[model samples]
Target: MTTATAFDPMSEDYQQNPFGYYRAMRHEAPAYFIESMGVWALFRYEDVVTTLRRPELYSSRDWINNALGEFDPVPQVPSIISSDPPDHARLRRLASKAFVPGLIKKMEPGIRGLISELLDEVQDRSEFDYVSDFAANVPVNVTAQILGADKTIARNEFKRWTADLIRSGARSVLPQEELDRIHRSVNELRGYFTELIAYRRIHPGDDLVSALVQAEEDQQVLSADEVLSLTFIIQFGGAETPSHLISSALWECFGDPALLDAVKTDPDVLPLVIDETFRHVSPVRFLGRTTTQDIELHGKVIPADSVLLSYIASACRDETVFAEPDTFDINRPGLSRHLALGMGPHYCIGAVLGKMMCGLALGMTLQRMPNLRPVADDVTWLPSPWVRGLASYLVAP
Candidate 1:
C-alpha cells in the first residue's frame, strides 16, 4: 500500500524549501488534494501547463477573493488578474496600452540611474542588507517613475501599501488583523490612485498613468474604478516579483562560486542567469484557479467549483521536463520555457519589464561589486505560501 504524502502550506519545512515537497507531489501525488487548505495541488509540469492554458476550464475569476473570503461592498471593478474571457481581455488591452515596448525602452536610462544611485548608497559598506537596501527599492522606484507619481511617494506610502496587499493575498488564510490591514491598504491605495487618476485627467504627462487615463477601447474610456484597479495591479505586481527575482538570483549565484564567476566575467550571460534563476527560484510560487467543470487527472476526479493550485515552482523543476531539476544551470537550454511568469491568457504582462529590471540590476551589481558574496547562509524569506522571496540577505562586497 502506498502511503499518501502529507502537504501543508503553513508548515515550516515546506516554507523553508518547497522544492523537495514539490518533487514528492510530482512523483507520488500528481493531483493531491489538501483537505486542510481545501485545494487540489497540481505539481507535474504537464499538468500545470495544461491547467494554465485552458483558462476556459480553469477560471481565475473570484479565486483569490473567495480564498481570502473578502468581497468589496462597492461594485467590483474589472481586474486584469482576477477576471476571465472578455473581461480579462478588455482589462489586459487597456493595461497593455501603457506598457508598450517603446515606453519600457524609454525608461531604461532612468532605471539604470536609479540602480546606480542605490548602489552608491551601499558602496562604502562592507556589509548591507541586499533586499531592503537595493532589491526592494529598484522596482518600486521604477513603478513610480513609469506612473509619473513622485518617487518619494513610492519610496514609502506606495511601497508599504502594496507590500501589505500582496502579503495578504499570498496567504491561504488571514487572521482578523491581517484582513483588517488588507482592507485598510486597499482603501488607501484606491484613494491614492483615484487622486492620481483625477490629476492625470486634467494635466496629462508622458507616463504610464497618463497613457492609461487616455486609453480607449471601442470608443470607450476606462472608468475611474477600472483605472484605479489597473494601477493597483501594475504597482503591486511590479513591486513584489522583480524585487524577489533580483535578490533570489544573487542568492543562487553567490552560493555557487562557478556561477558567480561566470556572471561577473560575462555580462552577456546575465539574461540567461536571470532565466535560470526564474526556474530555480520563481518569485511567484503558485497561482489559484477555479474549475468550471469536473476534470479527471492522475486517476482522480476534481469536481466542479474546486480550486486548483498550479504550482509553477514545481513545474519549473519537474524532473520529467528538466534534467537534474534541482541544479541551477545558467546555460540551461530553453530556460524561457519555464512557467515562472505563468502561461496562456493570464501570462504575466510585466514579464519583459521584470526581466529587464532584474537583468540590469544583476549586471550593474556585478559591475559595481565584483567581489559581492553573502555574509551568511542564514537568510530571511517572506512567509507566503504562494510567493517566494528573501526578506533580507546580508551581503558583503
Candidate 2:
C-alpha cells in the first residue's frame, strides 16, 4: 500500500523521521490527497517547485494561517504573505527595502553581541536546554532590535507570542486551551504592533518599523493595518525559524565529530553547515497554497479553491536533485537551491537576517564552547506537522 493512504502529518512517527514517508510519497504517490488535512500534497521536487513558482495558477491568498485553521472565518489580512500579484508585489517592494542584505549586514555587530551575551548566561551551567536557553533567544532579540522594540520588554513578550503562534500553527487539531492561547497571542501581537507602528510614526528611527513607517513606493505606502500584518509575519518568521535552524544545525554537528571540527576550524564552513542542516531537517516543512483553477498533474485533477500543501522538506531531499540526498553533507553541490526558505515572489524576505543569525550563533558557540556535547539519547521533535524542530535539546559545555 502507498504511504499516502495512511499518512498523518501529526503522527509521532512522522514527527521523528518524516523523510522515509516523504520518500514513499515521492515514489509511490506524487500527488496525494490527504483527507484529514483536506489538501492535495505535492511530494516531488519538481512538482513542489512548479506549485511554488506558478503564483498565478496557485494563489497564496489562503496561506499558512488559513491552512492551520487560525481564523474560523479567516479575516482577510493585508499581509504580503497572503496576497497575490499587484498587492503582493507592492507589499514586498516596501518590505524589501528594510530587509536588504546590505542593511542586514549593518546589524551584525549588535546581533553578534547579543549572541555572545546569551551564551554567557549558560557558560557556568554544565548542562542546559539549548532550545530554551540559547537557541530561542537569538532571533527574538534580533527581531525586536530590527523593529526598534526595547529588548528588555520585547524579548519576553515576543518570545511568548512567537511560541504560541508557532505552536498553534504546527498542528491541525489542538486542545481548546491551546486554541484560546493561540488566539490570545494573535490579538496581543496585533495590539502590540499597532501601538509600535503608531509610536514609530511620530518618533521614527533607523529600524524596520520606522522604515516601513516612512517607506513610499510610487507615492503609495503601507497602511497602519498593512504594517501591522507585515510586522506580525516578520516577528514570527524571524523568531521561530532561526531558533530551529540554529539548534538543529548544532544537533547535527554534534553527532559528527569531523563535521564539527571542520566548522570549528573554518568560519566559512559554518554557513555551509547551516545550509545543509536546513536541507537535511527543514524547520518549516510545508507551505500552503490555493488552486486558482482546475489543473491536471500525474493524471489527477485538482479542483479550484482547494488547498495545496507543497512539501518543501520533501523537495529538499529529492534524490533527483541532490546526490545521496538522505545524507548530510555540507560540501554538497547546489546547496543554494534548497527551498527551506522558499522561492518565487514569496521567498523569505528575512532570509539574509535569518542566515546571519544562525551562522553567527553556530560560529560563536563553536568558538566559545568548542567542547559542547549533546546529552540526549534521542531527538524529541515538536508535535507540530507544519514545523520540524526539536522541542528541547540538552547539551553540555
Candidate 3:
C-alpha cells in the first residue's frame, strides 16, 4: 500500500468531523502521502488555494473520468462533471449561459413561495424531521418550479435517491452489495428524466426543462444524454448538497441556544451567519483531482498524474488563515476565503443558486418555526467522503 492509503479518510473519527486529523496533517504531514489510497492530501489553506487556481496543471480530468466513466458504468443518465475539454468546455458554456445571474434571480419569488408551502406542513406540528419534512423538500421543489416540474412529484423519493448517489461515491471501493440498489435507481432516474425531456420537447414551457429542450430545437444544443445527465445534475446537484449544508448549519445554530437566539432576533445577520456556517461545515469535505504536471507545495513535490484531494474543511480552520479556528462563530471576519465552493473555472456552477436557496430555506424555517428542535437521536451523516452532510435530523419544538 502507498502512503496516502494508510489513513482511512472515511473512518468514524474523520467522518464524525475531520478537523482534528486534518489539523494534525497540516503540521506533521502537510503534504503527507496516503499509503492505502496512493494519493496526497494538501490540508493547509495555501496549498488548497494554489492547487485550485491552476486546473490546467492540477487537472480535474480524473473526477470527470471516474465519475461518468467508471464509477457506476450503467448507461442511463450521463453528466458533464466527468468529461474533459473540449466536451467539458462546450457543456460548461451552455450551462453558464443558462445559470446567468439575472436568470437565477428571477426564480427567487417562486422559491420563496415553495419554501413557505413546505414549512406550512410543519407549522401545526410540534416536532418534525428537519431533514425530510423541511430541508429535503425545499430545494427539489424550488428546482421543480424553476424547471416547470410538478412540485408534488419532485418530492417523491428525493431523500432516498440522493442518499444512494452520495453513498455510491463512498462504496466505490467497498462491498458491491452495499451500493447495488443505486444502479437500479440510476436507471429509473434516467428514464424518468428521459420522459420529462421528451415531454418538454413536444410541449415547451417557461421552466428550465423547456429551456434546454428549446436550446436543442433552436440550434445544435446539448445531446439528449447530456440533457438527461445535467437535468439529474441540476435536480440532485441543486437539491442534495445545499439541503444538508443548511441542516448542518442549523444543527450548529440550534444546537447552541445562544447562537440560535442571536440569528432569530437579528434578521439582517442571517446571511452572514449562513455564509460562515458553510465555511466551517462545508457540505463537501474533500474532492480529488489529478496533477497534470509536477508541482511543489510547502517544499514537497507532487509528481504529474498523481491524484490529490484538497481538504477544504481543513483549509477553513487553518490557524494562519483565521483567529480561533475551531470556534464556530457566524460573525467571524474573512470567512469568505474558505474554499467551500472551490476556486477557478471548475468551481461549483450552482454556488450562487445554492446559496440563495439554502439561505431562503433556513430563513423561512426560522421565521415560521422559531421553536423547531431536533429529537434525541444521533445525527447520521451521509456515507461519502465527497459530500459531508447528515442523512436525516429528527426534530421537535
User: Compared with the true structure, what per-residue lDDT tens digits does model 3 show for residues 144-210?
Assistant: 7887776666777555666667666655464777656877676667677788889988898767777
Candidate 1 TM-score, C-alpha based = 0.94
State the displacement of the C-alpha of residue 73, model 1, in Å, after optimal TM-score superposition: 11
Local distance difference test, per candidate?
0.84, 0.86, 0.74
For residues 1-397, what per-residue lDDT tens digits would candidate 2 score against the true structure?
A: 4376667886888878798899999988899888877789999999989888999998898785575465422245646878889889989998888887777888899899999999999967989999999999989898998889889867779898877766666445578888888888778777778888999999998889998888897998888777877777888788889999999999999888899999899998988998899899999999888999998988889999988999999999999999999899998899889999889998888887888889999999989998888886798898878888899999999
Q: Candidate 2 — which residues are off by over 4 angstroms?
A: 68-76, 170-172
TM-score of each: 0.94, 0.95, 0.87
For model 1, the local distance difference test gives 0.84
lDDT of 1 by residue, 1-397 (tens): 2233757877776777788788878888999899977889898999999888888889888654754445331237646777898878887887788878998899899889999999999978989999999999999998888888888889988778866766665544568887778788777777778889899999999888899999987887777888877787788789888999999999988888887888888888888988898999988888888999999999999999998899999999988888887898876766778999989988998888889999999989989999887899988778778789997999898
User: Which candidate number has the best TM-score?
Assistant: 2
> Poorest 10 consecutive residues of model 2 by lDDT?
67-76
Between 1 and 2, whose TM-score is larger? 2
lDDT of 1 at 248: 93
Which segments of candidate 3 are over 4 A away from where they belong?
Answer: 1-6, 67-79, 83-87, 172-179, 215-220, 255-258, 374-380
